[model samples]
Target: MPVGHFPLQDKIVVITGGGSGICFSFAQLALTSGARGILICDLQLTPAAQDLINQTPDEVHFMKCDVTDWNDLEAIPPKVEEAFGKGQVGDVWIAGAGVFEPKWSSFIYDEEKEGGYKAMRINAEHPIKLTRIAMRSAISVNKPCAVLIVSSGAGITGQYAAALYCATKHAVVGFTKSMGQADIDENCKIVCILPGMVSTPLWTGRSDAVASQFSYTDEVCITPEDVAQGMKEMIEEEKYPGGSLMSIAKGKLRNVLESKLAFANDGSEIYKQFESKCYAPIREIWNGERGTKLS
Candidate 1:
């Protein structure tokens, strides 16, 4: 395994929602890092093509896609292979497509079924479904790959009125953690990212709408570029093993502390030593001897 290596050289990368925002930024960086081709899938593609076609020099291809639609996602692998001209499955996929509700994000809403379901599907189920398919293809071909899940800080923190959004994000974080462990069981890598308040189209709106409660000073919102750079760093570094949990916010990057870390006492010994003493044995029993007991 090429750990801590910039390995995108001459690889085909597929990114859902790569048309704009953080994923777009990531694509630009990936191209500069030597990725041979990038296929961008998004419901809104014309703007990106128009903008990126003449604006950027990268080899960018556009695909019109609704990430919420399983059929659209199922067709991606073959399309990518056809474009890149290799039996190689996607070298990397960024599950970056997402949605946000405006006034209907609340549980108190009356007629907002579409908003709720769409947001949930786009933000949570879509990525999970796409990642499962990608994992299957990679394992079937015995190819190594990486998947970056763009979860949000709301996955950890709650949104006041946006209950459904928060629920979707929380589900994403849990699924990401599970998938990351699965990557360990397999040979691939799953990197989960939790970005704090970011400047993106998700927050665009009319001035007439009853002002957003989530707004902060310009300094509070991290640039999409910064988040993209953080993701690039994570993908480049081999130290970020499978099941890596990271947060990008306030123009800074750091690892999201696992639950076990909180239980460790402040002392001279390393945290891993405390982890070994406290949870290792029970984990073994639970995962091995105890879990094997059936009936």
Candidate 2:
């Protein structure tokens, strides 16, 4: 299917954390693709999310939701159903959430003031909880539902200074893999997107450091518009599967599973060695214990 060929006309779509950023851009794309109704929920009511919705021809609704809270997350299904005439939603996108706090920096040595727990709660735990609830709701409806998770390139390959964010993103990637099979029958596809730095409110003062780590040139930095387009392509084409990692930048999309090897020979060989040594216990526990419970 092409970008706008998936019958988005008259479809009901919901986006969490859609108040701003690429997620908000996605709402625009959804409207252009002919979505009939759009429900955008964010941590707090923001004018940006509402502004985007107001431009759409569709009936747009806004809700203040904290993704970390189960009750808040759970309340969305009913509200969306009511707005869309009650039934399965045609599309679902979780794109409005992210974290880039100073306290999350492992480089920040003052643990007492850093409040690392906030990063864990917002970035990792909250998304996981949201995914689980969304999956259950979508599955019960037995419709073709899609999930697009906004991750960073830092998640795929760790950065020296972004340890906490990296850890949270890595967990999201792992969660995508674990839940992939469970949601397959429901036509609930999960896609993890690892985008390079994009121009957004989040980048007001953080671009230089991120650019240096990714070796990104001034022109290489992407925009939220770019990511929103990529997401639309992914959802409509459905070319990528649930466990796939999509790296989108400079108008190119690379499937990590098909185009790359898990390991490569390098001078340090540290990463390969670390993977061999450390992954055994973790993989064992995941496959032996965690896998069973989730399955």
Candidate 3:
């Protein structure tokens, strides 16, 4: 309830998917805030990241990584502390690893006799794995921690014809919220950002393409910097509580009350009744033994 603020000064920060886009912006801003060290973990370095690499302070380092691989991801923390110092692994981690839906494939693709769920692997599972790794390492070192999960508007509103991408992002949103609530008195705070149509290579799949797509004009599309800044404020300002979700679009951000239950009037029996009706099928299928039967 009090005016809250946390500083990143001299903290060792770890960011997965920091090679470009909003993650790069976070890396840049973090250095300006006096971060002691930073590790950029990406599939590989990109040309766009060269300048950032050049500008990194004495201790910040970049490395090639595959977030989907547990061995690759788990190897990051030790390397970070070894470079920075032991038990000084620092607590700020941004799980920004993700990928867009396939240009030609559906949620489930059978290519060459092998079915794959690529989006689910990169966009959802990677974040969950990396977050777990970061939290476990931080807790073992007795450090305070925070994690930011990068999701998309699809996390809130499922996309048509892009079910896999939408499903993965939605999973991230749910996971972040659930973890925050599960560890309310814990040391780390988990947050999620649902960005809409940001200006980045992720949208066009080509470097030359405009940031806008899907009827969203270039002017209306938010820049990656916009998302980065909004997210920074949301965390540093402490305006939003742990487990809070916010929607970012066109350079503005506001709380996302995605569920009616979040704002239902105190003593609103109608909402209770409506919720019961809405959840009856789910309850019937998911409650204990009832969930085991197929029929």
Candidate 4:
């Protein structure tokens, strides 16, 4: 039987990167659970996300946005107010948009290029900025809010080939834990979802990417819907306190103890395979034996 009561009932939700993957899945579930309003911000809406807007023209809105751009992020507050009405803060805010260190914005390729690593900016810095924006918006209206930070298993366990990706995820895990202190006065609860091997475009799209080096076959990966359900439970379930790091893996959800997170995949063969994949190219780049390719 379907649960009758939805915690998100009548809530206003805002999700960044609600285009094609986990964020889009959560947006669908959020609407089904009775969210009164939802704003999806992404560079462009995928056909699926666009179709959702078509089906629920009244409750959902899409705004083209680049999460890494501060001006674009600064526009969200006004957009939220415009969509839902003045003085209304989103009840649930999800920093759900991220990348997996693609070549164009890679740490290995662009770590020292003009600005810092784009992956860090998108995966780590964007969430930090958005969280601050969200908290301030909630505080201004004296409203209680829930913020979900989309982290990863990589955040806890180290990945040798994707050191920068690992570092970006780690940054947010620590940031979310520290933000729990902010809830003491403002009632702005924050939590993180550290999903394992999700079958999303961010990880699965590039066949030659570092993420593909891992054993993320269908049997080993969970669907975006699976992670989305975990996200819903985290928001509605009382047991999940502020700063909780919930791990969603193979359709099972567990609360992660930060101290014990390192053991998540300690003896896994997939981890070993992942560690071995790009040692040569990475070493070549570091030792200046090969030219850096930034395209």
TM-score (all chains, Cα) for each model: 0.79, 0.74, 0.79, 0.82
| Better structure of 1 and 3 per lDDT | 1
Error of 4 at 292 (Å): 50
Instruction: Return whichever of 1 and 4 wins on TM-score.
Output: 4
lDDT of 2: 0.65
Off by over 4 Å in 4: 1-6, 207-211, 258-295
- Show the colliding residue pairs in model 2: 17-96
Q: Mind giving the per-residue lDDT tens digits that candidate 2 earns over 272-292?
A: 687568556644543343212
Better of 2 and 3 by lDDT: 3
For each predicted model, how many residue pairs clash, with residues at least 3 apart or on different chains?
2, 1, 0, 0
- Tens digits of per-residue lDDT for model 3 on 1-295? 1223656777788888898888888888888887888899987766867776777546578878888678888898777867776656656788887876554334544332236565677889888888777666655554556777898889988666567788998898888776653223345567788888877767655543223335546776888888877667656656554565778887565556442224343658996687578657644532332212121
| Candidate 3, poorest ten consecutive residues by summed lDDT | 286-295
TM-score of 4: 0.82
The TM-score between candidate 1 and the true structure equals 0.79
Candidate 2 Cα deviation (angstroms), residue 150: 0.9
C-alpha positional error of residue 178 in candidate 4 after TM-score superposition, expressed in Å:
0.6
> lDDT: which candidate is best?
4
In model 3, residue pairs whose N, Cα or C atoms come closer than 3 Å (at least 3 residues apart or on different chains), thus clashing, are none
